[model samples]
Target: MTSPHDALFQWTFSQREHALGLLKAALPRPVVAAVRWSTLRIEKGSFVDRALRSRHSDLVLSARMGAGRIYFYVIVEHQRDVEALMVFRMGLYMMRLWERITRDRPRLTELPPIMPVLIHHSDTGWTAARAFQDIVAARGPERAALLPHIPCFELLLVDVSAGRAGDVVEEALTALGKVVLWCLSVSGDDARLEREIGHVAAALDEVLRAPSGLAALEALLRYLLATHERLSVQKIGGILEKAVGPQAQEAIVTELDEIERRGRAQGRVQGRVQGRAQTLLEVLTARFGSVPAEVSARILAADEATLVTCTTRVLTAPTPQEVLGDDGPRVSPARRPPARKRARRT
Candidate 1:
């Protein structure tokens, strides 16, 4: 119950197939080749401290390699700001895990290897410290000479931001896995998610067609509902109907209706609307920095209906004025970035 983001991240990757797919994609080629995937099993642990809990979550999985076991410590960062001290964070997580291992095996001689991997996504690409050495305070040739003496570890980063999503090769991922990664990649941008809805819908159809899809779909829909403040249920329903058929749409819409009913009965509709106004302003600021005072006032004064209209145009609307323009909140054609021509995966 940490958040929708954590809920989805844990539920999806806990399954062996999804976890393995991501492991193969993110791990070193040699590590992939050596891992006895048949022996792979998830380890129960949480190394993310209380302060980091809101923005970060970790998954620990162990697999047999040669005569011993190796750990894959996967950390997913879902918040807006990048952690500048990510290297130290990774080291701390590894240390905590190792502590548990030592406690369990009191007579252990050699420590087991733990490879730290990060799955980070945000509005913009990563520009933080990538290596442990990057965060060191000392500099110059003298620092370089002492580098070998300092305990250092490099984190394997699988940055899945909007700008870097294309770098991910989806050929090996399952239908659900593909869609989860897809959702994570575009989680920060309503405009990007809008342009990519067709792709998502097609992928989601595959997930819903299965007999056991409802539970998984519920998790997915919940995540989208919580994250995308501007994305309307009607539009989501329409996309579902077209891609997966009406039955799927109806199932989801029914759940949504119940949520609205509860909100209305509890008289929390105004509070929800106010929260949406704040979220919308945050989105605008994250994308285009320092929202104008007039724009802030307009958002604060707007009702739920007015906000919905503005949400649709907020992505493509060039200026803050266009977001709440006199013309109205409607989908204006956005100049899409040219798609990267990827070599077809064999």
Candidate 2:
């Protein structure tokens, strides 16, 4: 089953206009207005594949709003959690894209500039670039360097747990953020949250009703619900009611329930597998004083057949040594080695 987070990630990039709107809302006014946004399709054989294997970016935007000006490129990468290698990955993508453009257009004057954007939802502090020198300095020498200064990408992080919904949206988007805050604040018991949910749901419904927005809205809802596990059907229904209307709430509820059911099923399967692995470890530890780290890891990684065999051995072994084979010392043998004695200090 596809996770909600995965669905949101997909939704963010699936529609060019939706992605453009998000960028316009998040970035500075001058930059947003100056760019005419559109999606960029990266084929399998393209240079983008050298750096990234994925078919689509979280969002790929092109800016062409300026008159008689070269259109710039922006690639937005969204991540639900913190990724340690994010900077390195972005660097690779930047490098590959730059190389491709340069190859296609030999003249430096002919190449258009590109920008990378990273959108993350994590509490931990993260930076898009590790070293300032990578952005400022050229690879070999100061004067003869091919590319001296590549504009470092921007990092837009949303920490859902840190603040109120209004604050979060405000920090990201002044107007729409308020809408998000209103939708999130609607409480089940409190009539205010319920009303707010209805309002937001109506707006969302209007957007989704449009042929272009339908797919995008579906993707966004899936992502939001998946990422925010605490979100309930009532809360979602409220939002849908406001965005899409009361009539669409039923369909939304059904979809949310289906998603929840799938998530629970996946969690249960994982729990069972982990439980069995832990049980096997405990049984081994009880039979043997301490199992070797490598052996224990192997046991944990073992299939059902291996686990059953080891479990049987654990129950039937007469002594700890028998359970662990020759690697372990005999516990009850009469010919056991004498305990080493410490020498008296002079």
Candidate 3:
């Protein structure tokens, strides 16, 4: 199944306004100024072939600017958690896209620029490798000597879960765009999401009246429904009505019917268990930089009660090992985040 986070991101960022705003906000100002904004367009292609989503050619998700001999691609990838091997993955993706671009223009000699962007939202900020060489296994001081041969390019990261993303979008995006981003930053975690609903409701209200507002609202509602389990549908409806005026119910009826039916049909115990295991692994990986093979095996084989305990501890645990150990990590860290740096005297 396509993840709800990916679905919401693909839908919201596909719009012209949000897509343009995202590229502007994430890319270097020099790069942004060089582009011809009027020619910008999201590439629409088939996803069946799975070779860079087949149709997108340049990326699984992408937009292009410039044209003919001058054109380049801006690739967008979204995530709810940090992936340890993302740098390696992006390197391969960029190459695949480059290969496709080469085939398209047989006379092409110089490769066009392709900037791969990663937009991730989680309670913890991004902590994975942004450059391919960072994840390369190198031992001793000789590793530094090997750097000259290793390919290196950093992926731009738009960490929407942090306060700075808010700053970027606040000035550049439309109301609907802001609502989509706000949802992305908080949707998966129930407590944080509940606390922030009112803040989003205000922007969401504005979105409801804008052109194609109902469609945007439907996407938001779908995200919330898929992500939240404790938040009752009745309460959400009431909030929408009070925040968005009387038309809210009528506007969302089609989405509501579809979502409700899907939810009922998918209330299977086996699926729920698998989901818990996957979510736990994602959380562990995001929290601790990476998970060990044994730790992953334990999690996969864990019972429902063990999963619940580990899930609760993941929020505060300093390391993945502590989740399965008697000595808990939920209380204290063995080392500070910037452990390599010495404290400076005042």
- Top TM-score model: 1
Model 3's alpha-carbon lDDT is: 0.68
Query: How far in Å is the alpha carbon of 215 misplaced in model 1?
Result: 0.7
Per-residue lDDT for 183 in model 1? 80
Better of 1 and 3 by TM-score: 1
Candidate 3 regions exceeding 4 Å error are 45-80, 162-169, 240-346
Instruction: Report the number of clashing residue pairs per model.
Output: 0, 19, 0
> What would the TM-scores of all predictions be?
0.71, 0.46, 0.63
**lDDT winner between candidates 1 and 2:** 1
List the candidates ranked by lDDT, beginning with the highest.
1, 3, 2
Model 3: clashing residue pairs?
Answer: none
All models, RMSD in angstroms? 19.6, 11.9, 18.1
Better of 1 and 3 by lDDT: 1
In model 1, the worst 10-residue window by lDDT is 327-336
Q: Candidate 2 residues 64-159, lDDT tens each?
A: 555422322333233323555555566666667667667866876644655555444333434345443344545566534444444445443333
TM-score order of candidates, best first?
1, 3, 2
**Local distance difference test, per candidate?**
0.81, 0.49, 0.68
